[model samples]
Target: MSTPMGRNVIALEWLQFGLGRLVAAAAEEGLTIHLLTGERSEYAHELAELDSPHLVVHDVNTHDVAKVITTIRAIGDVAGLLNTTDTWSLVSLEVRAQLGLAGPDPACIRLVRNKALLRRRLYEHGLSRADGSPLADTDDAADVAARVGLPLIVKDSAGTGSEHVWLARTPDELTAALDEARRVALRGHLIAEPYFLGPLYSVETLTWEGRTRVLGVSSRILSAPPVFREEALAFPVALPPAVAADAEQWIEQVLKCVEYTEGFAHTEFILTDDGFEVVEINPRLGGGLVGEEISQTLDINLYATFLDLVLRRRPALMDAPLTPSRGAAHARLYAPRTGIFVGCQGQELLSGHPGGPVLRPALPAGTAVRTIAHQDGCVAVLFATGATSELALQNVLSAAGEIHVRMEGDDRG
Candidate 1:
């Protein structure tokens, strides 16, 4: 039996939007969450407001693995931990193993965190797009691009949140992508592989006793081609039950192949004309307010549930069904151009609508902003739940338009 610990630690790198939600969930569950971040983030004030007990904010530089281990030990009796950031997972799992903490197996974590390792494992399990290989150098990238055809994808071996991902169409493009990828690869490791053009989505699941249970699917909206910016996400896909069933089936295989056990897994996949092909799996909740959506609608605090599992507490009984009756849509709001934020226009309007949007904006006025590729300078997020998918989309779009990002930039130029 997994012993449930009354005291828990939430070792967060940064408390932006998602971590904040995790903190709130932990608080609601009557668990103590310790905030851990580097020296630079201004996350303390926001966390202090939560009034969590012994909210020990530590400046454990995640890069220094030694210091991290020391810090974890210092937070004595912190029976279990939950991570809200991707970059911290590798370190967290490593530290957890060293401390005899229970969670997703460390090897499973390694496979999911490293893109190359993930692809290789998925391919071995017959879950990949087709013949693919991890690149060794710029020369290898060019070779793969040619063999895979134009429009190839080059990814970082240990990059998170699509930071070092790129797509190329020609020799020039491939070279440029390789340069950018090399710059962003973690510890300087990169993978160049074939790009699969298709609809992108995420399979959210919670595993217990090795059973991967579905918790709805999210359709991802990308910012632009060749960039990693995720503009939006929606839930309750309109795909027929049969197709969704197939997706669930595929997820089971992925969980087993990757050897993922216990805890949450956010599996990304491309639904192509060929079929569903695996994108890397995240051994945690799908990012971008997914936990919030699940919590609000299904009455499940995924963060709490994760803590419970890690502590070996009795799993939170899900009286509610996983499938949502009405579809929900979440849109990322970014500056149409680039400049310092002057404030969003209609936050009240966006929040006023009862069913229109569940507004969660990370940035407010006076925050410096830019229109960088693969980065949403999101001023706000508009979440809408409606009876039908179209209605939900319309509500979200309407709310998004109402909340305008005021920026000063050379639009004409």
Candidate 2:
């Protein structure tokens, strides 16, 4: 039999990314993970090679928060809880409080999840250009035009991964989006606001006791207008000393405004001609290789700090001086048309390219990709690293250009 770590940490249903890092962090901290997930297959990719001694999976209906709480109470030596998913974060917070474990405040989690409320709060504080107007079921295109104006974005206030988000430049497009919103179910009510114009970037930070550290910024390369889908991302984007300092100061204020006491935050913003405008603040690490990529870039496992927070200890990251020794980037693999995923065509070509590009598959073969307009159609991510952000981005793009996603019905591959 192997040695045992008597202490245990709780992980609610997690996002597909970052489980490996979280598991390693737990082990290093002398705490095994009691993962309460509704579906074990969601983590199949990571669990295959995981340190089995450090993690124990429990199947429970995470959606049913009451049942989730009861399950946690039965798990022995459960000292703290952590969750990176938008779907289960709230449930985790509730369970933490019921069990008397250290965690983020309940109100703070709810406020950040509601985009409309966050926009209004920031607008009141002059951090945003305009407040988002609530879209009622009875409201129409003209109502939105009069309230938030045209060229607006209509989105579910609680949406994740760019799902259920629509951009309309014309009144006709706005009408169509509104009609579609009526037909579909939303996690939260619809919210409309004037679209901020500029490139997108998400600043990853670690916070404790109202103090924050600006880890690094990731350049979000999104698709062309009408759809807000992510395409690629490069970390540690070069910024002037003053520009970087401004972002740091603004992020500190934003955190204070939300009364966020602790934990990681991935704040997405638009760099407009006027200045940086608040987009949405995710109360966890950036999704999909963002945590892993940044850990490599900084030469440190930031997830270690996550466990530190749950144990109610000062996160070492808060005191440590970070030096980003390398750069990293990732590009999404997209199929030309909606069909069943087979594999990639030119992955072999990546061995000849720079940056040491690695292809990470999100979906297994035979899985169907029904659409390319959103994140679901992104079959895999191609990650690469270099000495600088520009070079890493260049190498990733070059390697990605050679690889063509092979779909069942798409002939282009």
Candidate 3:
């Protein structure tokens, strides 16, 4: 393998909502982005449509490590390897390690990718209160229930978007949840843990060379269980000074425990009566326009900061004001029922709304809408800004209420 030093950063996948910002930032920094994605990914066409001189899309099987490495070598002069999505973090890390680039440690990526291992590490470090066990089959559900107790959550050890996650209120429910989880287990193992009831908050942090900085704390709106589908997010949410400090302290400890050296980390936790209990840690930026919301609230461009981190440069904006100049929120719109989508109504009202909420549909018209199960069921996302949190949230709600998806089927309630 020949190493060619080029002004190229290889992104393992490009389907993330924030890829455009990354590409734009890279272009501004006089860098080129070589996006490696599957041939069938919409990103291939999306990148082509951009016609950006700094952006190049390569059709390759990302799952094949050897192929990806070969492609990277063939491109040569690779300055960095990175990914902004959970599904491709490991792949990105592997490529970075193979190429001897700066990134999170491979062992750390392994620990965070496997929920069971993450729980174990946290438990050992006294960072977590809950106990969890890994289940490989339905037969293990009874033992897991006995260990973790009822009202527990059974989920794939490495699942995303709440996929194959189920809440079990009883032993029978536990078994059923295990069965459901087994069907979608990406790693053929399920993790069962006690479910804490409380509001969820995600702490977005950027770590570089082992130094961690908390970017923002965002409150999460989630769909009702047996599935923890995230519905919306409001950023720059106020937290008691002590609570915020403690959450950041915990996040820093987690990064240290996992030996995460660099990159953005999105850590989710429940604000319970006792204290903050960790839910999970995603080694990437928060999804669902979180970076955009943060940018609106704090005047920080996280996508640009991510590029600076990859280049091993200190992000100048890190010292910028952390206080929110304006409140920002993102609300997800889901299809009311399964049907063929015709179009969205009340879009004109949103265009003229006072709060300047931006409405973006996930799927275009003439798309099929299936049962609302996970985040994939979301039809659109409404982004709004206001002088206060209540106003921002209200703006999103008002716009979302007016915009309705016109579907063809009448069977769904």
Give me the candidate number with maximum TM-score: 2
Q: Which ten residues in a row have the lowest lDDT in candidate 3?
A: 40-49
Score residue 370 of candidate 2 by CA lDDT.
87
Please write out the lDDT profile of model 2 over residues 66-170, one tens digit for every residue: 898788778867767888888777777777777777688789999999999999999999998888999888898999999998889999999988889998899
CA lDDT of each prediction against the hidden true structure: 0.70, 0.86, 0.78
Could you give candidate 3's per-residue lDDT for residues 236-329 as a string of tens digits? 7778798788888878888898898877788899989988778888888888878888777877566787667667677666666677888888
Against the true structure, what is each candidate's TM-score?
0.88, 0.95, 0.91
**Mind sharing the TM-score for model 3?**
0.91
Give the worst 10-residue stretch by lDDT in candidate 1: 39-48
Judge candidate 1 against the unseen true structure and give its global Cα lDDT, from 0 to 1: 0.70
Using lDDT, rank the candidates from best to worst.
2, 3, 1
- Model 2 residue 368 lDDT? 79
